[model samples]
Target: MNRTGAALLLVAGAGVIAVTLALWGQPLVSASGGIRLWVNSIWSPETSQQVADWYSVSHLVQGMLLALLLRALPLRRPDTVLLWSAFAIGVGWELAEHTDFVLDRFRATTLYQGYLGDTVLNAVMDYVFMLAGVALARALPVGASLALVAVLELASSLIARDSLTLSTLQVVAPQQAVADWQDAIRPARP
Candidate 1:
């Protein structure tokens, strides 16, 4: 694609993703990624270790892969450009979650709780993963683009929130209370 065409495409894609993220907040889950990706509810040894390990490794792997993708871009090579793009996109999604009428309706009308919304740390990880991906692209399996995507996804399984990590980390709340509160509540019958 021509530079102008590519730029427009990027803009359009970003706009759509931003609008969607602002509308549809994504989910986060890990083998032990807290009760609700809050980071606070994680205490059990296995779960906590798993959460930490997952986030640490996943973020690294994802970041490298993102780096690769960014490298493939036909645009100017600027570090923050890709990272900030990711941040903007993540923040947009957080906002979208609150605005999406359907999601709002589902939570309000249907049975969903603790959808208190997202935070900035989520955006931070977006940048981190973007960096990771970019780094990977710089050096990897020659032509293993698909391989990169798979590794990133696999790493994400550790902390499977909408983005690479959860937003709860952005807002610091003590784990004790989070665990107690989460434990006190029971899930609604599906």
Candidate 2:
């Protein structure tokens, strides 16, 4: 199979897995009930399922990073490979989020306070969001891609009270200061 073909298969497979997770009882959207394309409505000041939410940008950043990693490989088209790789990673992440260990950690930690997990629709959309990032990284020069990631990360922090780095820090270290600041700023869940 060619790289593009394989990449497409991987994406399809990941979609199937996400659907399975949803059917297995994962929420599809708002705990109350909501599903949207393009963007999620603002549930709170700090949180939204917007198509381009901070979390969605995180997926894009992940795609950019993945593109950088795949660039090391001597593939015919590294972008294609990166897309599939990002999809695989995204699927794995979604599955992991549904696991007891990850969920328990969120419950224990301040970073993901009140976090249950992504809904089926959101999980699927996240993969799409990441793919969009991968596309951007592939289309732009490396420097530009890096710049984009930086901009997105900065915007996410300013608007969402969280970014990839902030979330990572909270998860890995769990600092009270970070948690307090985020808590104070994040919108209260309805």
Worst 10 residues of 1 by lDDT: 41-50
Superposition TM-score, candidate 2 onto the true structure: 0.81
In candidate 1 the C-alpha lDDT for residue 116 amounts to 38
User: Which segments of candidate 2 are over 4 A away from where they belong?
Assistant: 1-7, 36-52, 73-80, 187-190
Candidate 2's residue-wise lDDT over 1-190, tens digit each?
4667756765785677567877778755666554444442223422333334557778878877788768767999665666567767877787787788888776676756577676666677677767667777878998888888888889878766787888778777788987887778645656
Residue 97 of model 2: what lDDT?
70
Error of 1 at 99 (Å): 3.4
Q: Cα lDDT of all candidates, in order?
A: 0.42, 0.69
Clashes of each: 25, 3
On TM-score, the leading prediction is 2
